[model samples]
Target chain A: MSAKPYNLTYPQLGNYDIPIGFLVRKGLGLAYTSPPPMTKQTIELGAKHSPDYVCAPFKCMMGCYIEAMEKGANVIIQTGGTCRLGYYGELHEQILKDLGYDFKIMNLTLAQYGGIMGILGGIKKYAPKRKWSQIAKVIPTVAKMIKSIDKVEDYMRKNMGFEDIPGSFEKIYKHFLSKLRQAETTKDVEELYHLTMRSFSRLPVHKPDDPVRVGIIGEYFTIMDPFSNHEIEKKIAMMGAEVHRWMDLSHSVLSCPDDNALDMLRSYAKYDLKRFPSSIWVDSQRKKIKKYVSEDMGASSVATIAMADHYAASGFDGLVHVKSFGCTPEMDAIPVLHNISADYKIPILYLSYDTQSSDTGIETRAEAFYDMISMRKEARQS
Target chain B: MKKAYLGIDIGSISTKGVIIDEEHNILASVYLWTEGNPLGASKKVIQELASQIDLDEWTVVAAGTTGSARKLVGAMCNASIVKNEITAHAVGTTTLHPDVRTILEIGGQDSKIICVEDGVAVDYAMNTLCAAGTGSFLTSQARRLGVDVEEFGKIALGSKNPTPIAARCTVFAESDLVHKIQMGHKKEDIIAGLCNAVANNYLNNIGKGKKILPPIVFQGGVSKNEGVVRAFADSLGEEIIVDENGHLMGCYGAAILAHGSGIEKPFSFDVADMEFVTREVICENCPNHCEIICVYRDGELIDSWGNRCERGVIRS
Candidate 1:
């Protein structure tokens, strides 16, 4: 008799599901259930179950998992991060168990720490017949898919304001993303990427001789997800400005292993000085942030400020720093952002997002910020 | 015929309207309480302003709207421009006081600070989330202190040693004020302390890290309070320039924006009595369930909003 097929689901974060769904279906040969698009009810459900002041992303993810469970998702998968997000899988399992959800959890963070061999072993449990060579072959292909996806999106970000037709770019972009979903092989994805790029290039773009350039840097999840920050990038682009976004799944998650290699070496030198001296573990990210902040401000604090400093020096007209409300790491980055803004003579707008329904206040502030930057740009040109 | 421009500022607490000509001369102005009905208050404001001006000699060719309800009133008045309070206030103040560098405005429910450079607003912050040290905070405390809010400012100036109150939460400040009263602090001192607390709170929150350069021109509903003005001057160590027409700046700025929009549309005073209606409908197309709000004039739907996706949008 055939064993039960593993039906898995992961929390929705921007366009990440496309890659994740591919991974589960093609690599593990298992079912990948797509979590429903986030809505008011999703937020409400998440907020109701989550601890007060536990940060917005946590609650939002909780709501996503619960919805996935309802749709026959028997295995919930989540990635780990250095922030509070690292322990989300454990806490979420406990909560779902308490809610009487009969499901297994596969946290990829441990696999991430153990490297490719660990990931192959984890997948072998689900696809018991699959060989290690087959799993190893899919990793590079998935990495390429991620890079191609981000490239298409990056092009859209730079050109959203310049579309000749009101929404011609967005119309074509949706078509492109849909086509991307249909690509089943590396050759298919690479060909589609080139084809979409060529198709997008043909669209008329009426970018002015000099348009305002704005860079956005913030919490990884908030910057990447549209629902969390109220589609701020779109709003800024609508004001006839080119937006330069700093985070991508390829860079943040896929490339992070290489990015943190230098950090790991530094932590090894100061090994025993760690808070958990009894354990044989050292936090690499905590040591890397010492370059920006003398002390560890906790969870991705260094990256947030580093982005601010990098963007300001790049001479972007303005910067928008957004984060989930009650996020301690982003809160710690605020003072440093102020110093960066003042030093570089650049303007910055700090937005702390909660589950607030109205976008009126946010719209007003963005419009004003756009006006200020454009006026400054015009004055410089004159 | 002289072409006049109309500007209306519809705040949560009050509705302000002004009519100005090409020479920047205010021909008519009116301020009235919104009373939770912005449309009605705006209509009343229009009626009052229309009565003050000679309609036969001057025709309003362009109109603008500002403040929290700018969009709602802008749709009602067929305004050429709908500006946020920050832009409206900055434009109005700079036009009146060209060399101004900073603007400290405290409205009924919200307060804002605008740091200006070369007559342009460089940065601005609005405290819409908190009400611990706003105009309404002072007003409610005045009622509890048994001193008329309008006259509270004058009485505050009499105190030599002002009492200290927490400048954080409005609830905490209120409780602290009550405690101070029980502790036998003089009424004038307590009032003076309240003014200082408001100024300090603004500086701490809205004006944080912003270079508060002079000449600082203070405006808005709370700028009418001389005691708060004095408190700001003492704290910043700079003289505060309170415009005589401070409260009407939003309306004036809106009028200026309308004139600059370069789109000429003749506005008639008769729109004040026109019937306007709004309805909310839930779209059943998708699971998103977006509630679309549509505005109608004379039973004809003109505009609608509140759809997250394009499938739910009903374009007129």
Candidate 2:
């Protein structure tokens, strides 16, 4: 007989838990597991086996899927999107199958057929033991869990740096995650969410009589994925400065397209006087969709520039722009960034990430840059 | 007043410096191993250059820095201009050879091909991803063959019939060299084969799909290897120019850039006496803990970086 219960695994994206939770409550799985975090080794392994010169994210996901297989995940779930990521599930499945791995790939994304019913059917195939009635009973709980996690994270990000004490957010965030993991009922999940939000709200923040604030701008995946960008926010915060980042998923989905365009315009205006210049164009529609669907997908040049302007106006210290290697949008955005860096006299540190094992060289470079900016700030103050 | 400019190029494997007079003629030049400590290496380079020149005849009006550690070394020396190797090399080469159409630089760690027209670089490609065609490759192969790297060129020149070795990647090249050696290939022939392999690898990787024209000046640490220079000449079917000051091109370019920057204030050599140290702090911004580095001089931070964001600016 097949295993009585199983956990479902999916590659990470913006707020993936909500969808995973939704599927699990519908009686398909016991726990929703995110693939292991992407790392240098992950990228290296992925690139070694993957087709040469594909986008970096493709290699990253390939690595994540291969790693998950190694972890004894029997069934894999993949979400379909407009970008090439939508088709990645099929390719990943085929590659893994050729390697003689025994697993089922549940692809929710269908190029020809797409709807709520379609996704439900896909989940049902993997979760054969769960009755449809039982599956129906769990959806609300999963939705609540997702909402709770996203809300708490959003609140923490905006206020974490301003906390009166160091490690306060971290302390509460750990408790929050543990509670989230153990949450059995919708009410329990809701209660945990409220507590986390409260802790976030209560974080002691003094309006810096003269705060050095910085905006972090970059590609969505690298910007949001701490591993990819090298924990730039923490470094910036440790510098006794406030930090701002505007590339969250909630902002992308809830906000209208016009708002995104307007935001882009506001940021671009700083460097170029012309409004809404279409700088980069990819021939691949799937690539474009991948960028559009994710809030900070591709190179988040506009968001970074806008946030940098905001931080600069707010008397922030500097800006940091991070991108994966060979991100074209960022390459196009750099000239404008140079102009903004000069115009505001705000130092901007640009970091490009690849799958190299060594972090020593990167650390040395960062140390020197921080010292230079800090010295400048001190010089001005004295 | 005879004005002079100082340019320093601190790379991963070597440190180079050049002192240039008002006319951009090298007054003093020095090259040494970076020895894993850029600050110390730079200080030594500065002292060596100082000892070689008359301080009264030339006052350093500005200082420039270029290379991977340019920023750190630039900060240490109060550089008027800190540019990337590409810009620095282009400027330096264009100044020395006004009609140069291409600049090929294969250094210890990296290789670059610059397409120049009208004394300005139009396009360029740099190979930081591979180690097959760089000076490090030759150094490793020299170690394997029990030959000193300094004698690599002379040994290659002695080869009458160089063996044909695979030149695609380092692993394949090593295997091919081993196979050829087992087949009773002469040491000189193997050395020549290795030189040719490096040239072929560079042409296939960095020089692919580019218009490589003559008036080509080869520069960088690897340019000192006459075997590789000869290999390049044979591969391209053209005579390659290797200047006596080729290895100093990066520093020369930086110095030229510094002079033309229009910064009139004289540079002081007081940096040699200052004590600088690098400190690292873990940035707990998110799950990816980035170790931000900060450089301090006499207990005061001069610069910090290594963060993906502007988060590690905490100064006491």
Candidate 3:
């Protein structure tokens, strides 16, 4: 007999929700509720229950869980990360239970579960009657799907600022997301990725002969999630500059060198990199980064500094570092980033978001930063 | 006829304005206390600037605005460029002093330092959550000391031996100043010490990690104080260039940017007489309950903001 139909939901981390929901519904035979897109109410609800000092993401997650629970989601799937988010499962579970919401926590603690397959085993346990072969094939497909979703968005970032039509990029992007949700198999997803790329390239663009390229390196959650960072990557692109961001769900899930040939990642670095501070260092700076920050600074924290160093040496005009307020890993990584910024002589703009500051403040800073780099680039060329 | 561009910087403590010609030369300038009403202060500034310029001989082709209430006043004046004070200050300073590498700006409510490389600001740091070393702090201290804040620089200049005051925070500085006064320290010495404290606090916080170099341009309301300028000079071991029009730099920069943007929308001085109204609306269409702000010009809606999503978009 088939197991009871499980109602599941996951936190909003950018538009990855499209692929993630498909993985649950089509891959695992579970019904998923896309909790109302995280709004002011969602954050407020989460902030009310969360501890005063926990990072914004934790509270945001709490709010998402509560909203999903109210909408009849019986199980919550949480993709754990390197920092405090790993332990958020236990605390969030207790908070929800205290509020009397019946749900199962599919907290994929990658370390404790013994890598990706072990987490798959945890998911398999929920539907023991299902055939193992079918579920096993779906795991890699889900990973490929996420990689594909990130790949198309990656290309979109570079040229969205130069779209001939003002809202062309967003229109194509929203359409791609809906098409991605309708994708049934790994083959279908792979086709969608290429098709999306060709469509983006065909769009009318008016890029300058030499565009200003900026690297965005920061905390994983804030960088990946647009709502938290005020759609920063998009905003930067809209300012008539190309943005290169390395942190995303695909990079985190599949490890460095996104198994999918992401053209954007190729120029970033050229090495087989593990999660930790593997040898993906920019040329002639391996020794400095090793000495700049030691191990135990966390993976992304280590990667952020390395990326900054790499992007700086690669002649990028500027770097933007975005982090959620009270993010421990980024807090440790900031000073190191400053040193790299100074040493490389590349301008870096630091943005810390806690949900209270107005969007105009961020926009002003971004506009100023854009002008700085754009001016610097023109001056150098002259 | 020479086309003129107008720029206004409406800060929490003061409203500053400048009307510049096509050459970026300041033709008309005015500074007025905001008195907690930005709209009213901006109107007064417009009237003052309008009177200074021959309206019949010149036309304000475009306008720009900067500072805390840049958007509010930008809407009021139909600004073509609405930029931040940091960028405006950098642009304004660099235009006047091209070789300047460091800019230390302390305004009424906040302090920020911009490090320039090749006439473009590369890095900047603002006092994120501090109010210790700012104009308002010094003004409050001056009020407590029973001295006109305008005379603080002259008095501080007379003191050779400055008293030491703990100015890491306002509360600590207030108590320390009281104690120093009780200890029979001369008034000028204490005033001089307050200047030193302001400079020290700024360098320690906003200027931390920033390489302070020569050709430093100091602009803002705080830069008007000779005592603070001397304090900065002594601390950095370099002369501080305090522009005579430093108070109008933000607005000056805004005006320059408006001219550079090449978007010439005619600005009429009659905005000072026109009625602008704003109202707040609680959007309850969803659970978000976003507080939407609607701007009206002559009883018709012009703009609305504060919604997070398209659902909150007002049909004005």
- Among all candidates shown, the one with the greatest TM-score: 1
Superposed by TM-score, candidate 3 places the C-alpha of residue A75 at a distance from the truth, in angstroms, of 2.7
Docking class of 2: incorrect
Clashing pairs in model 3, backbone N/Cα/C closer than 3 A: none
Q: Please report, as a residue range, the 10-residue window in candidate 1 chain A with the lowest summed lDDT.
A: A273-282
Residues B1-316 of candidate 2: C-alpha lDDT, one tens digit per residue: 5889999999999999999988999999999999899999999999999999888787898999988889888877778988777778878888899899889999988887877666656446566446777899899989999999999999999898988899999999999898988999999999999989888898988776566899888888888888889999998888899988888889999999899888765577777778999888987765446677788887888877766545555654
Candidate 2 per-residue lDDT over residues A1-382, each given as its tens digit: 1553565676655445445645664456566556666655677767876767556666777777777667756677765443345566788788778878777777766442355566667667666677888887876776666656666765555566677787888789879876776677788888888888877777787646665556777766677666555566665565455566766554432322233676445433342211111122111212333422233233355555555555666666667777777767676666666566556666666677766645544443444345445445655677
Chain B global fold similarity (TM-score) for predicted model 1 against the true chain B: 0.95
Q: Total clashes, candidate 2?
A: 35
Clash number for each model = 1, 35, 0
TM-score of each: 0.92, 0.59, 0.89
TM match of model 1 to true structure: 0.92
What is the CA-based DockQ of model 2?
0.05
Model 2 native-contact share? 0.00
lDDT of 3 by residue, B150-192 (tens): 9999899999999988868878988999999999999999999
Q: Tell me the lDDT of model 1 at A180.
A: 73
Q: Which regions of candidate 3 deviate over 4 angstroms?
A: A1-5, A110-121, A258-288, A294-296, B129-132, B139-197, B288-290, B314-316
Order the candidates by lDDT, highest first.
3, 1, 2
Kindly indicate the candidate among 2 and 3 with the higher TM-score: 3
